[model samples]
Target chain A: MSLIDSISRPRAVRLPRIDGLIQWIVPLAIIAIWQLASVTGFVPTRVLPAPSDVVLSGWKLLLSGELVRNIWVSFWRASIGFLIGGSIGFAFGLANGLSQLSAKLTDTTLQMVRNVPHLALIPLVILWFGIDESAKLFLVALGVFFPIYLNTLHGIRTVDPQLIEMGRIYGMTDGELFRRVIFPGALPSIFVGIRFALGIMWLTLIVAETIAASSGLGYMAMQAREFMLIDVVVLSILIYALLGKLADSASRVLERLTLSWHPAFQKR
Target chain B: MQTALRTALPETELASQANFAPHARVVREERLAQTSGLPLTIRGLRKSFGDNEVLRGIDLHIPAGQFVAIVGKSGCGKSTLLRLIAGLDKIDAGSISFGQDVKPEDIRVMFQEPRLLPWARVLANVEVGLGRDRASQDADARAERALTEVGLADKRHQWPSVLSGGQKQRVALARALVSRPRVLALDEPLGALDALTRISMQRLLERVWRDQGFTAILVTHDVAEAVALADRVLVIEEGRIAHDVVVHAGRPRARGSVELAGLESSILSHLLSADDRT
Candidate 1:
């Protein structure tokens, strides 16, 4: 959490305490104005509740314990889906990248499936998995797979041929060449895929939870919408935005840790 | 260069040796072939990329511990010949033999680009040249000594990206030298450096070759560099050895000395006329 803060307020760009406070002024003012408008009836509470009302509803949910439980459930689903899809995609990428036979066997079919939007398969997914947790997990996994697969393949393929040649001339076996040279060379591209997969992971989870999920942020939003509890719905959206930002920041930290030797990531 | 020889011999011998200094260096080189470097012989070597024959019917023999420089026009097959000698590429016909069994680590090539693994630090990059022995106990010490030889020991912990162009090339040299190769094939290794850096690097190359006694095969376009450092300069034209020039310049020949300048001009003219023909 502190690392994420440091990235947002980088030491090079961050100013003194007074200026640091100034960075938050615009958002605070917007919230204040929003509260004023709700009190003065400029906007109907039914359509869009005030930020304070959303906070109150969030507090109520926290006391009742649904907020923590639902958040955990959503986080768990995304983690499991991301892991399953990311690993399989990486395996396929290594297979195709290293072996011409594997590429010729599976590349055409993968490209064909990649053309069909994964979200479009939601109806068929529902029919196949019957609108349960499996349906949501499958959708999330399918949505995240293609980006990781394509990027990992490209990353491996695009590694500098000269470096590979150097490795060969230095007496590196095929396995050592991949481990010492090719994989590190491909990591920057792989990180790009991870970030893309994260986006798709969240998008899939959002849609998946709405399909009869008994627990999760998306299900909470759906239940609140039916009851016209606008504040709860707004709170759930805010929570998602926060979670997505956190996930992205976490990945960026991982990227920096792994690729610090890269020119772009090295400390100034 | 003179101080060591002068101290080793008496002042009377030094004065008498001035006239035959070049031959004295040659005699010393003959002694350097005690078994460190392997002598190479090639017979009717031929290589082609499709229909365009790169090296046609090449025949040559190089003694162990001899510093040879090959000069040519861009497509004159000097690099192709070097690649064949190093076994980086296959020959279409004929043979290149080291005259003995040579291990995988016995021959190494340093290309124009540093080709250091950017993901690896300077020391790790140098360690790569040790072949299968990179995991041995003495690998780190050997790599460090090679870096110290190239005068970049201070930069061993840094990434290759952070080094200057000349420094990166030095690191590459260290990597090539760490393996203690019997044959070192240099494919225009200093072609990208600035003039001053190139000259300094040349001096370093000469010093290391003298100390380690590797069979150095340098492929370069600079005739001045060829004459100053090499015992023999081979000019390639029409995919064959067009001129075999022997330089008798003594150790540490002064830049632009009369003897070296004459050899450089003659080789440059050969290269330019080859260009004119094309």
Candidate 2:
């Protein structure tokens, strides 16, 4: 047989396909049990609002445009903070990775600073920026920067030296060497940084918004708790869950698109 | 023979003799005049790593379009010699001169590993050999032609991860040849292949070398492969040339013929004896 035919030929027996409904079975069953318990008074609705009540509250907020407006506000803050932090991190990574002088000058100081929890700086940030957007932006940016910077530096440091030698032998100038070999070799790690930073971005925003902000989903949830509006609080939590899942899914899609050439992603 | 005379002398004496060899210079110049491609000349090449001297005052001269193979035991510095010639490393002492027509960028080396960029398609990886000026429209066409030469034109669009070992090496060969280099250096390029695939690749390499007419220097430990592909085989021992044999057989020679086998056994014996001395 031909090589490609031998490799590409299917070996496993065909299995029946399920259209992913199997995944929803358990979550639906849990919702059904919860709804039954709430209606039959097995569990009091005051302590835990019914899923229907949470949905109704979400719909009310949506019609009033409060939910959308808060979401927009939170999204922009996260994006701005992420962009500023990610850019700085990427630049530092490239600098430290390519030059030993830069690494010697900055790497030790950065490592020492990164160990301190960024959230611990919240009080100081609030003191410095005074409850404005700057405080939340500073917190989120601090949280996201370390993962990106460290991973980018690691990725560049770990590229195969043999490949670099190959690039040099093939007549690539120093700039060409960086662009063709070093940058692409470092990209997979940078993507890892991006995904991790995105998670940290949301987490830091939530803390920052809750502590000081008057306008975001975290603030809404905090206000609902104060007023004993359990449905709206549950609704806010659900919104965060959905947004987190959406962001993670978006990262996965980006990974698939950029890393189609990678072997880890090629196995079906 | 000159090989016998050179091997009989100690390395220090040989290094001194090489400094005053007027006859050798005349021969080298005549060879250069007759050759169409780049000729390589190395004089008293020496390299050391910390305390372990890898190559000690080695000298070699290769005429253009000549396929020369260097065979030695592991750590005998054959690969190091090829690396030095390919300009991948600096020489501690010696002069290496190429023909006037040849630029430093006109030499390409292929390692045992294919070393294709995992993030690039086969064609794009081959086009990398064309250097940074890949914006020209002809870059793709030249890469496609090289792929066709290696019988991998159909596989150009596929990722390097999908290629088989032999196929990947062929892609590497395509990349090395895409620039139409005047000199090609192979550092055990087929060492990782299976026995059968290795034979086929040897044939393919021979065919490519014949058609391209580039000066080819191959560093291999396999004695049979050295005999099968090289016009002249130099056996390196303790960082110096111990035996130099010119194969009298012509191209398309039978693989299992007694003449080739005789040469292979003699080279193997020389290698084994060199091992015994160390």
Q: What is the interface RMSD of candidate 2, in Å?
A: 1.6
* Candidate 2 residue pairs that clash: none
For model 1, the superposed segments whose C-alpha errors exceed 4 Å read A1-30, B1-35
Best by lDDT: 1
Question: Candidate 1 lDDT, tens digit per residue, B115-226?
Answer: 9999999999999999999999999999999999999999999999999999999999999999999999999999999999999999999999988889899999888888
Give the least accurate 10-residue stretch of model 2 chain A, judged by summed lDDT. Answer: A1-10
lDDT of 1 by residue, A67-145 (tens): 9999999999999899999998999998998899999999999999989988888889878988777887888888888
Of all true interface contacts, what fraction is found in model 1? Answer: 0.91
The ten-residue window of minimal lDDT in model 1 chain A covers: A1-10
Report the lDDT tens digits of candidate 2 across residue range A1-268: 1224324645464343643465578888998999899989998989998999989999999999999999999988999999999989999999999999999999999999999999999889888998888898888888889999999999899998988988887777899889889998998888889888989999999888888999999999999999999999888887887888788778777877877887766655
Worst 10 residues of 2 chain B by lDDT: B19-28
RMSD to the true structure for each prediction, in A, is: 6.8, 5.4
